[model samples]
Target: MTPLIQRILLATDGSAYAARAEGYALFLASTWGAGLDVLSVLEFPPGMNPAYPINDVYLGQLRKEADRHLGRLADRASQIGLSVRKQVEIGIPSEKIIAVAREHGDDLVVVGTHGRTGLEHVLLGSTAERVIRGAPCPVLAVRGIKAEAVESAAASVPLAVRRMLVPIDFSDCSLDALEYAVQVAKQLDAAVTILYIMEPVAYGLDFTLSHPSELEAKRARLGDRLRDLTAAVTGCGLQADEVLRGGLPADSILDYAHSQAVDLIVMGTHGRRGISHLVNGSVTEAVLRRADCPVLTVRSPKFAPDHRRVIRKPEPAASSG
Candidate 1:
């Protein structure tokens, strides 16, 4: 199977961000020769229960509006030469989107975030954030869109995305992310820049005075590992580079990307559990918050084989004979 997204679900709430997502979705669909499925979730009207006293007319009107929204998105996607499909569902937006994506075998889910931070995200509780946490596949969150003005602002992004920036920590997850990034860069006929951040904690005051020498040794070792890391990709006719930087992991990553004006940031989420993930938020989240460009997050897989060497016993009698 093609690892790149072949079936994409673009969820819209008639928001401006949704519209921008649709435009990006179209571009991705065309570039990857994928199918586009646009979905709009109809929220339950305030304090209205489906089980309560009926009003067919009102419900029908709501459904009609939902249909109208989905239809417009479908038409627009079609105009962009994408094979499009759409559906409107009523209930919680994130739940319905997750359901539809799973039911339709969507490889990627595209949703819009309002770019809420601090108190705003807390007050409103972002649906995009919920979906990202709960999604079965990779989720692309595009913030900064209002629901009402989607159609009017569909403009082309003139920049051609050619370089992909990938941050690696040499963990299994980071390695997997690097692999995915290399594959994507190869597909786009672009180059890959692998960034390794030397965390601040790795160099505390308590550390030895010869820490600089130790760091240099470690850098050389990491360079060798990076060489091995890029071997397969380079062999497959892709260009790759390795960069080492020191500082906060996420900040360093974002800074490097901005300095290089990279088009995309591809990183992996270890998808850590509970307190660990909460205490040490994923770099994916940090990049999502700070990046001026697009970010693609690949979730790491978790299957390993057991390979223990078994020592054989010699026949003592035979040896003596």
Candidate 2:
């Protein structure tokens, strides 16, 4: 089978968390024998005048520092037998990272999130979140590890994909993520645990819920559906298991993953933006922020595949203005 991930882009800010992300990127690239790109962006403060002499000097210094950091990372990757290209760009960090991934048609993007929450996260928006929302392909968001843990495991720790957890909601986006997860499982000879969360509903205080028998019947039906979904995966010659839980989706998924010691989490995001996303919080984003393992987020495809087309069409010539 062809490799699912061919080109990987790893964006770094020279932080400890980013270094951990780089470790995962390097390991994956070596395992897949894929090309890797190390990208670093120099971000300037908003409202800063670039034309000012002092500002220009500061910008040049920042660029040089970024270059040096990327150069060293590239050298490290090479020393470990992974070939990588280094890139340095000046722009908004997340925007430039996404732009580079699109321009290169990279199959996967790896980034680190600091896992800030509440008012802090609101005031300082997450770059990893924006990149995942806008990336053209799949994104792997690595959560930051504590300093002491990094100190102990930084050198030899590798991301183990022996067990993978995938949360499914029967949405096209979730199914797409499942398919990708199955492919990765096949490659890694890993097992996949599919989870379906039935969110608890609270009726009005005056209303009473259904009978126990009726709830059991509903749970049985959902279990059947989950089994049906896993049939394809099992038929693909990989071990698969299904679990149905009742609770908050994100919390349930994370709890299951931690309890099972899952090495990876593959899930889908609807990619909602702005007010819509704020109002309807994203389960995927929540999981990404707190997942102990690396979370791979695949956005829903805009267009379905055309299976009827067997032959390729020639490109039209461009007209010169």
What is the lDDT of every predicted structure here? Answer: 0.69, 0.79
In the range 76-125, model 2's lDDT, one tens digit per residue, is: 78887888889888778889999999898788999888622222223125
Q: What is the lDDT of residue 125 in candidate 1?
A: 43
lDDT assessment of candidate 2: 0.79
Clashing pairs in 2: none
Consecutive 10-residue window with the lowest summed lDDT within model 1: 303-312
Model 1, residue pairs in steric clash: 14-147, 15-146, 15-147, 16-146, 16-147, 17-145
Q: What TM-score do all the candidates reach, one by one?
A: 0.78, 0.84
Candidate 2 displacement at residue 255 in angstroms: 0.9
